[model samples]
Target chain A: MHEHQEPTPETFSTPVLSTTTATATAVAAEAAVPGAMLATPANESTTAQSLSTASQEPRQGEPTAQSNEIQLTDEQILTQMQAIKDEEANAHPLVDNSVDLTELEKEYENGSQAFKNKIKNLSDTHDRMRRSRGDGNCFYRAIAFAWFERVMLAKTKPELYTHAIKAMEESKDLLLAAEFEPLAFEDFYAVTLETLESVPTSTPEALLTAFQTDEISNSIVMHFRLVASAYLKTHQEDYAPFLEFGQTMDEYCSMHVEAMGRESEEMMLIALTKAMHIGIEVAYLSGNQSADEVNFLPFSPDTEPYMPPLVLLYRPGHYDILYRKSHCLEGVV
Target chain B: MAKPMFARRLSKELKDLAMNPPAGVDIIDANDFKVWKLGLAGAPGTLYEGEKFQLEFNFGPNYPLESPQVLFVGDNVPIHPHIYSNGHICLDVLYNHWSPVQTVASICLSLQSMLSSCTSKERPPDNANYIKTARANPKHTAWAFHDDTV
Candidate 1:
């Protein structure tokens, strides 16, 4: 048993200086080690400065090395690393539905021609983008927002709302069968039901505003994620082959698929789409696409022509809700 | 104030636990939903057979999303390799491996089994040193749980 010690007097006094130096060193180390900072830009200087101010004031301590060469305990280093991770995690909003597409175009102006073309393809289809926070829950958030919008649209149609509610209620058996304790997921399910219940009385604008509210939106997303996890677990045989590496189905879901803020992959999408009996069209705008073409991948494509599909726009690591003009009007009719 | 969702879920869990109390586990005090005190009877066939232990559970606003802070409390803390003198339990299910799907009942059973599997009656090797510096809340400590055999 390795006993963890309190920060010694020498290490306690200059936590700010020590943590700053440590962060800078860690960033420098990442840059030094090839394949460590690949694809991710090294935000060293900004991180160092932010970390210096963000560090808590040190407790009393004995005189130690000069501030420039302070030493940090393993615990202090871990805390600092967690703080940096938290800072990065909260860098974006839970859902920003008013992002301008031109901003994306401006970002890739000087980038590769292929990327530029992909941007043009995206611009042709989407007038704006809704940015989900990069906290690794983007897929769930995007789907939740889209689902709420659909519910709100179907409010005038009693049969549609009833069908959705029936689907939601039936999902409880699946979750229970998958060994999920009702105590752990009931509140999420309740909140989701409550949100759907409110749709009939609320205007679409009001519904949109409520969806933007963090607490309500996140709960709905969490509920969806849980349902998706249950679906994956119950139908493990269908998804096990898709698991990369040698990880077992339970391991994959617990670590990635079910865990909050763990980014979604193709397997999660497939499970969710199939479980909800909802068709999803993901418009992929990637640099790899043909010069003037975009790729639209259908997930759980609808066999019934009358069912309105849930569409999402996918760019490299993020997902956003997408609206097709005709589909939006169809709900009104 | 606790988040509405957390409070609601905890209430449901409290009701469920009341209806279906696990063997060898009793809810001692649950006046406050955020904090619960549970009494556990050592499972038969365990080294700690015939002993009773108290466990404290403190839930954050995140509740199911984040794991609750659980620690052994009271005078009769179990002396086992994974249980520290200060009452902090070194269980992976209480930490990194925690999932929202786990409930208080499941956790109690896991701890019960953990105690049942122990063969030694001695405290952890570094128990004295760790207790001296351990934080009031075990969640604050960065626990490195390497032993899983027990």
Candidate 2:
């Protein structure tokens, strides 16, 4: 048994992050097919940054590698990729440095009974899951559900609800098996928004517009407009200019900003919460989407023209097959 | 003070757990914010039965963003091929598939369910040699765990 489980002081927490482990883990990664470089911090950082900027800019000059057809078998690339990720992990801090749970604890302590009680429960649940070694379990699912309920419940503010709903719907479409191309976005947006307007309150009708997009249902283009309008309203402080415009629904959805008032790590949490809401709505809407459509990308700010409408395509058998193949590559499960 | 949004989200998880504790879970260590020990009752319809298991969790500075590393502890550590003698569990959601959306109770319940669902009681095929090698060169020797059945 090793006496010291922690890394040495020289390496500290940040430096000893396994650069090589990223490669090793990339090899170990389930969805990550071969030909993709091991997930180094540098690689992820650059990729994540590009993804952020790309979200802003239109899909104009960037080379859409028509060679997306290049295929590297999972097995052949696993070893080299894992080695690379492992190396990357060894060198860079894989996690953000700005989290201070202690402060959160203090805040909870000083807050309202409902607030403190609510927070303490979450903390306690988190603690229990950790101790139980229940990493991949229902504890995660339950938490996800709770987060979803809370956000939806807090939908008293219309704009927040609208933004949250639209974002959630888009995520649902992406994670579900059936594909809705960018061409479908405008139609989806228009009809969905008109239906949302018809709903006097936050009702199931609003939910219906998200997944069921037929004639008796609503036009997809109208759907996008209503949802985008709600989003613009909810985030008025950040998106005031866009709200003023009679801009196209695509133009409205295209505007991206650095998630305000939070560190990058926290931003991930917000994104995750948002993703859960998307999943919940999908489930309620009887849409085929899964929770994976939540944008799990890291944060980086940039100035660029907005990209064309992008859609998430959900693949049902992908995750399990990917998990199995990933284990095979690492020669470990 | 305006509560940080993440904290509010975390709070929501706690409320749900208290209202609905999964079938066989007990929080052993409640005071320490970072260290948690959970007790899982043997799940029904699986290999783990009438046996109690312990799991330990260590949260990082970035609590929600970074998932806690979990280790199975105590004598009941399953002798399955996938599980090592030491309680370190190798599951993806704990690391890579981890999203801040998941809460502690959900994770434990999932583990409990997985434990109950186990059909085989054997360690991974290479367990013996890996254990032997790990005894001396713990850091360098990585266990090549390979088994889908268990």
Using DockQ as the measure, the top candidate is 1
Interface RMSD, all models, one decimal each?
A: 7.3, 16.4
Model 2: per-residue Cα lDDT at residue A220: 31
Query: Per-residue alpha-carbon lDDT of model 1 for A1-333, expressed as tens digits?
Result: 433335232223323333224323432333311122112213322333333322221212213334344555556654765665455435544666555677667666555576577767767656666666544576898887777677667656777777677667867777888888777877778778888888788886676666666568767878888888888899888777766777677776766656565567766776677777778787765444345666677777223422476778765555667766566466631
TM-score per candidate for chain A alone: 0.70, 0.21
Q: Residues B8-70, candidate 2, lDDT per residue (tens digit)?
A: 434554455567768877777644455677787787666777778887776543444445667
Candidate of highest TM-score: 1
Q: Name model 2 segments beyond 4 Å from true.
A: A1-333, B1-11, B128-149
Provide fnat values for all models in the order shown: 0.23, 0.00
lDDT of 2 by residue, A1-333 (tens): 111111111111122222222222322323321121112122233222221210111111223222333333433333444454355434322111222223334533533354344334434322211000011111122222222223333444345445545654654454232222232233333344444444445444343323222231213322322332333334446544423356442233332211111111122222333332332111110012232222222222232211111111111111000011222233221
Candidate 1 wrongly placed segments (more than 4 Å): A1-93, A109-111, A154-159, A244-248, A285-292, A301-306, A329-333, B1-3, B122-134, B144-147
What lDDT is obtained when candidate 2 is compared to the true structure?
A: 0.35
Candidate 1 per-residue lDDT over residues B1-150, each given as its tens digit: 155767777887888778898879999999876899999999887788899999999987677776888999999999988899889988866765676777899999999988888877878888887887665766545556666666
